[model samples]
Target: MSRPEVLCIGALLWDVIGRAPRRMAPGADVPGRIRHVPGGVALNVAVALARRGLAAALLSAVGRDPEGDALLAEARRLGVLTGWIVRDTGLPTDCYMAVEDSAGLIAAIADAHSLEQAGAAILAPLDDLPAWTGPVVLDGNLTEDLLAAIAADPRLAAADLRVVPASPGKAERLEPLIAARRGCFYLNRLEAEILAHRACPDAASAAEAVVARGAARVLVTDGANPAADAIAGGPTLAVPPPRVTIARVTGAGDCFLAAHLAAGLAGQPREAALRAAVEAAAAHVAGRDLP
Candidate 1:
């Protein structure tokens, strides 16, 4: 296999999602669909990138258990490089479970304790970051301290860095990257609001606010609404996503990020890249597979 052009660093685990046909209320029980698949922020992005024909490698942890072995085999089959992935013999593979309804995602829980425990060990492969000048997708699932350490690591200065919060709950953990103006951030409106500590009525405002907070660049998406792309002290652009029926919400943001990166790497202009990202996300949310 050729060397990977992109490195995705973060969670790599099984996703258990339950989807109901209607909006779910607290304690409400309804018939839904349940399935297990390989997922997690970094893994999701890596899979999408691979589907787009990009050589992406994972720099994360999985256990040495059966689940981990299966997950690794699946990743390799999906064309994602797993050689750089750390296998923790002492830790079981991680998992994430989410509940979504016709309205969208309702609740979720992430059991990534093993990954958190693995910590900086996942990055052992990249000890010489300066020698690898490639695009990196950094997931916010990593501990804040470890993220801060990476932000301070001078070796990463030569790489094209992109940071994404695994979820809105973990958005604030990206503060160090923002303060350092290190990478382009891919975020939803809610995540942007959390990181900027303010209310943003729309994706445009959210993107601007994050840029104001010293992010090198930010792309903010609002569900079924316009998505914005803003660069610090530069241009702010917004594009509306194609209207489509809501399907699965999991991994939508990751698909958007991956598509945007793919577009840029393919020489698409800024406006075109934003449009492609939004369209890709809309398709994913509508139950279309990555192409």
Candidate 2:
């Protein structure tokens, strides 16, 4: 069977992660090694999708520099389409550097300035694509204005759409989608709270709060208490993930999103999709084999 396209629209670049066996405190220098790997919500999701033997593409911006070239090459080699990536001559590929420990993520910084500054121009390439007739996995890293416009883009209403808030800080960007009834909302508990401006104790509650804000369906994930609330004539489900030692956290959410997308596209029921996503995410953070 021919696979449908999954478009990941956001920052794409190299990640420099420093791992430590134990936690670190302020001014406490730790011994760790740095490794450069392909990273970014869009790119990570694309990689996960490819790992599932799906057709995925990156519809974002990249730099004209070597990092961009190398990353693009690597993405192509992985069977992800890079033809939609806009190579800016002056802009540099963005990246995120973080320090992770045995527990989970502590403090990290994202350097996606180029992606934020590039604005709606980054999506221009998609206007002409004929093969991109499938669901687009939109990320929240994009500016609110761009996302709002996308929420109202009639061209995309022809295809299935799944939008994710990159995290808590950018969760508000997803509001337009809910307001316009464009796509399903995939958010963690904290992110769902941020979008609703309400405090929710669990994934189901967070999803209810998000649904109150006019979202048709909300996939709410809280580290282990996974719950999904739907409005498209579907059943709600609760699922739990296996506990394991934490290894990293940055790309975990992306892995979950990709797995969920793949599972749902394969006609699995909501419970199956939620379980699949949580398992994939658990495997990712635990540094186990891909789920």
Candidate 3:
């Protein structure tokens, strides 16, 4: 098989999202909608890239169970290449559960135990392939050891690595990447603060702090506020997102990262790429299905 333009590595599983149209408080049993969709940090990014006409492949683990079979089918339907995914018979498919209210994501739990348990087996395909110097989108959902190994692996040293923290809780798990200065980091304000170990009043401060901590490049986003994209020894670019009434919040950040990477791969200027990413995120939150 031919190599894909981009490879997404990390969690690939179902997203079971419970959304309520009204404000939610603890212990409030309000009626809501629950839907199971093909999701996960890597999968979401791959789908977003595929939607933009990019050839994207997934490098992750899935079970041999029925749910895994269904998810693989959905991934193919969405144009994501699953040939590199490891189907482990000993483990069950992973999943992510989230609760969202009108305000935003109230809480989330990522049950990515299988991917963590699969360890290095999920990455076996990379060993057989030629040295990939293209873009690789990596998520923090993988175990810390695996992430460290990937960071130091010579096979990926020449690739354009783009890493996301996955969430605030997993932010510190990206320390290996940050210490190695291996990739362009993508994260929201809270995740940035966690990684930087300081409170960032705004995106600009967060981006600066992360870069000071040896991040080669960083993008920090604050909802509705301006976002900052910073490169070492370069001017930090800050751009405000288009304000829109949020219809959903599960995959907005993934959409933003994918759009930015796609624009960069297309040779768009730095500022232009950041603008396109914010625009894509705004459209996603506004429930606009982008092509």
Window of ten residues with lowest summed lDDT in model 3: 282-291
Model 2, 68-178: lDDT tens per residue?
889899888877878767776377888888888777776677777778777877777666766345878888888888888876676665667778877687888777888
For each candidate, give its TM-score against the true structure.
Answer: 0.97, 0.92, 0.98
For residues 1-291, could you state the per-residue lDDT of candidate 3 as single tens digits?
567999999999999989899899998888988989999999999999999999999999999999999999999999999998988637889999999999999999999988998888877888887888999999999888999999988888898999998998999999999989889999999999988889989998999899999998999989999989998999999999998987889889999999999999899999999999999999999888722
Please list all clashing residue pairs in model 3, or write none if there are none: none
Q: Rank the models by TM-score, top first.
A: 3, 1, 2
Q: Which residue runs of candidate 1 sit more than 4 Å off their true CA positions?
A: 128-130
Better of 1 and 3 by lDDT: 3
Model 1 collision count: 0
Better of 1 and 2 by TM-score: 1
Task: Decide which is better by lDDT, 2 or 3.
Answer: 3
* Candidate 1 per-residue lDDT over residues 1-291, each given as its tens digit: 357899898999999999998988999999989979999999999999999999998989999899999999999998899898888638899999999999899999998877888888888877744466779899989999989988876666677889999898999999998888889999999999998899999999999999998987899999988999999777899999999988899999999999999999999999999999999999999997623
Give the number of the best model, judged by lDDT: 3
lDDT: worst 10-residue window of model 2: 226-235
| Candidate 3 residue-wise lDDT at 232 | 94
